[model samples]
Target: MSGILRFLLSGLAVLLTSYLLNGVHVRDYWYALLVAAVLSLANVIVRPVLIFFTIPITFITLGLFLLVINALIILLVDFLVPGFNVDGFWWALAFSLILAIFNSLFDDITGEKAKRNQD
Candidate 1:
């Protein structure tokens, strides 16, 4: 139940982020949901591998490289999902940052983070 709520919130975040960013385009609410699911899967499956491989660079950049990895994940989602488009790497980066902010805000509002910490 919580997982489903989280998924819906994530989709909302995607839609809102794309609406705010001129360079990011989401075809509709359904596409936003699809993007959210694909993005979550990429973060779960691909992010760790990317972090492991880029440890040296991540360290050298004082963790800033994680942002690049996040942008790359956005690009990967753009490629895999139809009706979702990011203008370029810069746009993808902006989209990622904004989406993260929205997700964080949603989590806080829903007390999801508090529940997670208790668990």
Candidate 2:
């Protein structure tokens, strides 16, 4: 159940990114859903390998290289999925930053602990 909800939220975040950014286009909600799933899978599978290979650069940049990795993942998804397009590297970078913001906001909104009383 949580997985389904998380997927839906991620899809919504992708749609939001499409709307908010000029160079990113999601053809429809279905495409957004597919993009979200692929992006998640890429993050899980490809990102770690990338991090391992780029550790020296990542360390040199004081962890900022992760943003580049995130943008690359977005570009990878764009390449793999039709109907979801990211125009260029700059656009992918902007889309990735915005998507991260939206995903964090979504997590806060849907988080179980968020509903718990502070008392």
Candidate 3:
């Protein structure tokens, strides 16, 4: 299924982000794949609750606090599994930036969603 391919691609993105931003000690491709799987699961299950809790601060910061959210996501991934290790908050922030860039490019190339109909 395309979903599986997308998942693999997302994993690749994570691996690439690790290399470019954080010093991910991934032993092999499988490690990255595992990290990707865990990251996705955490995002789906835990992120909403975190976002809800941070809403007031997020609003106060005029949405820049999303960077902290991203760092937390990275920390959560590191906590939930092995093979994905970011050194600190700065590395996590860099990881988040790379991940966002890679995913946006992937979605654009794959036509993953409809363009906004600005009318």
Candidate 4:
């Protein structure tokens, strides 16, 4: 799918996931789109540095420590975005895991799987 399409779909995923989890309150879908755009940028920029810095912990935990990183990212988003509230550290952890799983499935269905498989 095109980048615009992917972006829009990802925004939808965020909206849905936000509704499912108690993490964020979106005023409307436009707010969700804004949240998703910030999230995508953060993932592209912030996540790499985090992964690099935490490689030791990741290795020690056999990669399970990624959950903590994900939680931190989620918490970061909550802090950065007004009206998007994360209840607690544990809530961030749970919310990110669910978001990750759901977004993976969303991407897979939206031609991401084909693109990756082709690559």
What tens digits encode model 2's per-residue C-alpha lDDT throughout 1-119? 87799889889999998999889999999999999999989999999999999999999999999999999999999999998999999999999999888888887888833654553
lDDT of 4 by residue, 16-87 (tens): 877887655666788778778888888899999999999999999999988888788878888888857778
Model 2: colliding residue pairs: none
Worst 10 contiguous positions by lDDT, candidate 4: 21-30
User: How much is 93 displaced in model 4, in angstroms?
Assistant: 1.6
Clashing residue pairs, backbone N/CA/C < 3 A, model 3: none
TM-score between model 3 and native: 0.88
Poorest 10 consecutive residues by lDDT, candidate 3: 110-119
Tens digit of per-residue lDDT, candidate 3, span 1-119:
76897888888898788777635555567888887788788788888888899999999999999889878888888877676677887888888788889988887887775433332
Q: What residue runs in model 1 are displaced by over 4 Å at the alpha carbon?
A: none
What's the C-alpha lDDT at position 114 in model 1?
99
Q: Name the candidate, 1 or 3, with the larger lDDT value.
A: 1
lDDT of 1 at 98: 95
Each candidate: what lDDT?
0.97, 0.92, 0.80, 0.81
Error of 2 at 92 (Å): 0.7
Candidate 4 local Cα displacement, residue 48, angstroms: 1.6
TM-score of 2: 0.92
lDDT value for model 4: 0.81
Q: Mind sharing the TM-score for model 1?
A: 0.98
